[model samples]
Target: MKELDEANKKYNSDFVEKVKKTDVGENLKRIKIKKNVYIDSLIQPGFIYYIETGVVLRSFVDAAGNIKAIDILCAQEVMGLRSLIGRVGVQLEIKALEEVTILIIPEKLILANLQDAYHFLCSNFQYTMSIMYLHWQAMLSFGSERINYALIALAYYVGTEKDGEFFFPPYITHDVIASFASVTRSYVSRHVSKLADDDILVNQAKKMKIKDMDTLIKNTPNYQSF
Candidate 1:
């Protein structure tokens, strides 16, 4: 376990070093965010963030007065690119799921300094498209199957493989899952229990594990090809 932890640390360090070598990364300002703190208002126009460590929960209050989790981002991911590109006012509320370190870079600087914007643009586009697809899938799953769709979407966002087993981060709770599913907490709990009973998922001490990846992908609607 200690070896695994060390390997993960080294991997993250190597990734950060690679990012730091980029033109936009060279001039970035690092900011540390405490857990549960709101960061949306801190993001001004023409600025974007790059996650260096920890998790960030992107959520927003809907028209029905309910806060919804739009996405969960971790290290090596970019945030606020959509808002910057659209030149729109900030609408998303970003919260730190844990102690987070991010590098803030001005959009103007990136555009001016980066020789090849294609890679950055492609990365942002792909992430945005995935989130958009998740929203679309959730909308399609509205009535009775929403929970399943939400679980698949959440897995796509934060699930990682360790020793060939897929698991979600320990920080992800029923409430967070509820927000992602846009369902009630009770509903999430019930569905999660059902998944456990069905042997699709296992709620363990520190994480929720997907028992069979092939079975899960096959059973989840609109996720078979994903």
Candidate 2:
């Protein structure tokens, strides 16, 4: 996870530098978003955003009123690309998990620059493939292992590391994990408690910390492939 974070940071830095060298980059607008705020204003057509800092939850509510978490984006992520490609019809609910800073770029600007457009598409493709891979892995698993894998996946994307331990933010409650795992909140709680008891992880104050990565991987079937 640490290596992945560093890689993303480097990529984002390089991408920003490349964009800044172009004329379109001069017109980029930066904005700050408060935690728990919905970005309705940025949902307008012909714009995309680069996440300069913090995390955001991308989700959708079904007709049954079930909220499904589609993505948990952090620093270096690009948002609104799916809409530009005409791949999404149902409106996605995007809310900040923490204070966020983003650089807004016009859609036309990106389209006019072949290199920028290609990089944007490549980043989106990598992200989509990762999500698809996790979905496929989850479908092949069952019971508590699925929940564990969900935690692992979440940690990979948004968990912060300090002194060799990984911690998920307080905003990521059991309900959020349940939504990500496509499981009931109670089921998620039970698995989480078990992991806590085993000293593999601990959940308190609405935050989760992973203590034993090896044990966690062992409990999660086929997690090494992830």
Candidate 3:
């Protein structure tokens, strides 16, 4: 699993390095953003962004005016490709999870510069497929009778490891977890407490950490399939 994880990281790094060699990176405008900063979609309709560092949470406001987290993106991920290429409007609100650096590239320039847009499009398509798979997994988890396992699955999906502990990159709150898992905050709190008591999860400085990855993964729905 560690080897596979390293290979995946290498693949993403190589892909991003390839893109950086292209003309797109030569003209990209680097922007540094602080945590919790909301990126307005209207600010750059014809531009797409590559996340150079940090994490981003893509969310939408529900009818009740509650923010629902849709996806969490990390380094080497591309954002706004659908809106830029399909001419669709960006409906999701992008919020910085931590201090982030993004490289903005105009869509028109990419099309004009790339000798073969196919490669670029294929790379983006692969990322889209991964995101779709995650969404599908989440949907299936939500369909289950138990919400705790679903939340745990989500935590595993988006978490990053440091010093042998897997931590949620954005330091997710119970409210955010509740919103994503379609449960009440109290329900999430109860499960969280139970997990902590059981030593499966640990809370340190407001960040949730997985104490045992193997145990957590074993408890997740359709773990064998994963």
Candidate 4:
């Protein structure tokens, strides 16, 4: 199991396979967190946190003090990476959407534990940035690729599985996805409804199922393929 864990760490880069996934109660030092544990609440004098479950929103306030969300991370994203690297506590708030079991370790301890995972994290930072840049440009592109790529990412990250098909997670309020896709919920909804009308996807139990991958590739919206 130890050897298998290392191989998984090498291939997956998150070391999720290496960590012991004990149930929430089994932890000796359990910290209970309620919803919206203010994104910056996790940062204090000395600790770093790893996600146990639930979503974490990375957000900031404008000069007028209105919150603007910058990123949403579900399971596995390290909270307070900047502080762990070298700095004061993170300026970003990391709120939880539900009860979560965050594994906490002192910043220095985590740095000590990183002897093996450093290579993985350093290389994977490029991957993370590239992904962010792709989504950033997706809506700006004049072609159909933006929407398509966004859907692919959504499916891989948050989609559900049923009856041999993968579907978008349920209760993904139009408002939420709109933020990442860089479109208004109304526009996202109209496009989504159109796909369902054409059977490219289906709204089943309030979830969007990607029923036809080939059709999506063959007939993209506003596409001009030879």
Relative to the true structure, how large is the alpha-carbon lDDT of every model?
0.71, 0.77, 0.66, 0.56
Candidate 4 backbone overlaps, count: 3
Give the candidate order by descending lDDT.
2, 1, 3, 4
Off by over 4 Å in 1: 1-27, 162-164, 204-206
Better of 3 and 4 by TM-score: 3
- When summed lDDT is taken over every stretch of 10 residues in candidate 3, the lowest stretch is 1-10
85-198: candidate 3 lDDT, tens digit per residue: 666543788888788888887765666645544565665566556655655666566422234544564555666777767777545778767767666778778877777888
| Top candidate by TM-score | 2
Question: What is the per-residue lDDT of model 1 for residues 4-62, given as tens digits with 9 covering 90 to 100?
Answer: 22343354344345545665436768899999999988877677677888999998888
Query: Which lDDT tens digits does candidate 2 get at residues 1-226?
Result: 4454455556656766666667533788899999999985576566778889988888888888888788788788778776767766878889998999998877766766667568657756765776777777876888788788888877766777787678987878888888877778999999899889888998887768998877788888767553
Candidate 1 vs. true structure, TM-score: 0.80
lDDT of 1 at 26: 62
Candidate 3: how many backbone clashes?
0
List runs of model 4 lying over 4 Å from the truth.
Answer: 1-30, 35-38, 44-46, 59-71, 86-93, 136-139, 142-148, 161-164, 217-226
Query: Residue 103 lDDT in model 1?
Result: 84
Highest lDDT among the candidates is held by which one?
A: 2
C-alpha TM-scores of all predictions: 0.80, 0.85, 0.76, 0.67
Off by over 4 Å in 2: 1-9, 24-26, 162-164, 224-226
Candidates in descending TM-score order: 2, 1, 3, 4
User: Which candidate do you rate higher for lDDT, 1 or 3?
Assistant: 1
Clash count of each predicted structure: 0, 0, 0, 3
